[model samples]
Target: MTPAARKCLDQLRTLLRPASVATAGGFRPPSDPVTSWFCRAVGQPGENLPQWNGRPMIPILQIRIDELPYVPEQLAHLALIVVFLDMEDLPFDKPHGEGWLIREYTSTNGLVPLPEATHDFKPFPIRWTRVEDDAPYWEGACALLNMRALDDDEEAEKAFYDDFQRYDQTKVGGYPTVVQSDVGVEDFVFQIGSEEKVHLAWVDAGIAYFFRAPDGTWRWACEFY
Candidate 1:
């Protein structure tokens, strides 16, 4: 990795660490995604991403530096979460298909220890349930979001799809969704009023990336892309 990229990666990891969570204080509305907090903490220049609704939107990273306790050692062994957006329809000459990829780098060596996948895929760090289309994945995510309230399940699901249709017209692939059935389900759930709600983060090819909040809640950050 180049020195500049390495520096940014280090900054990102440190910014996401639990210790840094305490220093992350802001006054964004709850409707905002978790990426807002990350943008606030890291202060990275926003990229010109896709637009949602009539307004443009940018990429956002959601991170909770407070809710999850940190172990100094764990920081040394961290996973790099990389999500690929809108790769399904690259130009005819461009390589296409697949949207998300993850690689774990050791702070000790700053290198990817594992061999790369045959054609250059980094499959470790996250067990992703890849969905070829966005609708189903978004539906599942919306359901997980309001898991406690089933009464409005249908409406919630429709709203998610409608929003995506209006804003994200591209074919989205490699979108990852994790539910309670996954190994770390319990840890991913937000405890509220005797109800354990599952957390979810979904990103399209353009703007809108969701992240886990400090209180174990889920939030999304969106801007004109």
Candidate 2:
């Protein structure tokens, strides 16, 4: 994504509160088929999980985007997103939404109560803290500076770039702190980190990055210790 076309994205800190946490966001779907698929996706049968695994899906967390500090114009349609994971065999190498999924809801009206979680991974309402916009890449840096590249000293510019921190945590936006492989500016969405407070762990303290690929398929990857 270019600076003129995209620029930077504002990020929000997504913190997991107590398991008994309550929030204004609705948990249940309004008899939506996709929502039903989410509830029964784990340890059920067919293609997804819940069949050979025989393990229930866990609710990692949920966020009310409409209640967030700010929503990018491109993602205004999203109203809520529920984070999900399985007992084992995550989607590290498999297709997306197989072992982990981020269920996006366009609206929260008329939402009913969700079914009971199969594991101790109780759903926690997310708390958001708005963070300053991050320089997504070199192009973003240029945009923030309001100048074209190549005017500054090479070493100084490199140092300036290095000084930009890669805020790695469960966040709503901003650039991803990739532990392995290269993640670009386009197609990258949000990420879910290992939060021990709510007993949420991904591949042993790894952070899971969710992306909407150019082909429109959901893709997920995690980085662990």
Candidate 3:
């Protein structure tokens, strides 16, 4: 990896570790989908389906950190947590897809590991970077945001959603929601709450991304692609 790329990765690691206080934007549902599914499956008022491809669809959580944690060991743990929560509501088989977890920095050739592991597909050019220890690592890490995308088989999808519905139904209450957006990737703002949160989320595709708030509560956010 270039000295520049490595630096960026280190910076991201710091931001993700102990975590940082920053306005995060992604996608999530106003109502917890799993909770809603359980309620409806058991005959109760639950949240409607998430919108996808223009229809009510499942929302996936995607997190991007401007800063990473100070400790390096904790980075993997934090990333895993984000991955688990993001796919917890989706219908899928594995936690992150079929293959072994591939960790790499985003690059113009695709996703290139620090050591430059051989793989298929060229990397994509990275738009962000950071300086660390006078070396370079990829600016940020990229892993499958949702596990549902792992198995293409319909059975896997069904199993994933079924498990998700069961898990949601068992929870006592719902999680709080947060919303975020950007106009042409310039103007950015976010809000966290109940109805107000939902309305902001609905303005987009209704797909809200979630992350652990500073208070430990899950907050939702979304960006218009």
- lDDT of candidate 2? 0.51
The clash count of every prediction, one per candidate, is: 14, 4, 37
Task: Give me the runs in candidate 2 sitting further than 4 Å from their true place.
Answer: 1-52, 135-162, 214-216
Candidates, ranked, TM-score: 2, 1, 3
lDDT of 1 at 166: 18
The CA lDDT of each predicted structure is 0.25, 0.51, 0.24
Query: What's the TM-score of each model vs. the native?
Result: 0.21, 0.62, 0.19
- Per-residue lDDT of model 3, residues 1-225, tens digit only: 344434433343343211122222233423321111101111113323332233322221112222232212312233212111112233223222221111212212221112222222222211112223221111112221223232454554343333221110001112112123321111111211112221223233333333333433433333333
Q: lDDT: which candidate is best?
A: 2
Name model 3 segments beyond 4 Å from true. Answer: 1-17, 25-59, 69-93, 98-225
lDDT of 2 by residue, 1-225 (tens): 233322222121121111111222245433332232222221222223223256655655556665555454434576666656775666566675677666666776654445555665444444455666344445434434443333344544454456455556676566665555555545556667666555667666777776776455777777787
All candidates in order of lDDT, best leading: 2, 1, 3
Residue-level error in angstroms, candidate 3, position 190: 20
**What TM-score should be assigned to candidate 3?**
0.19
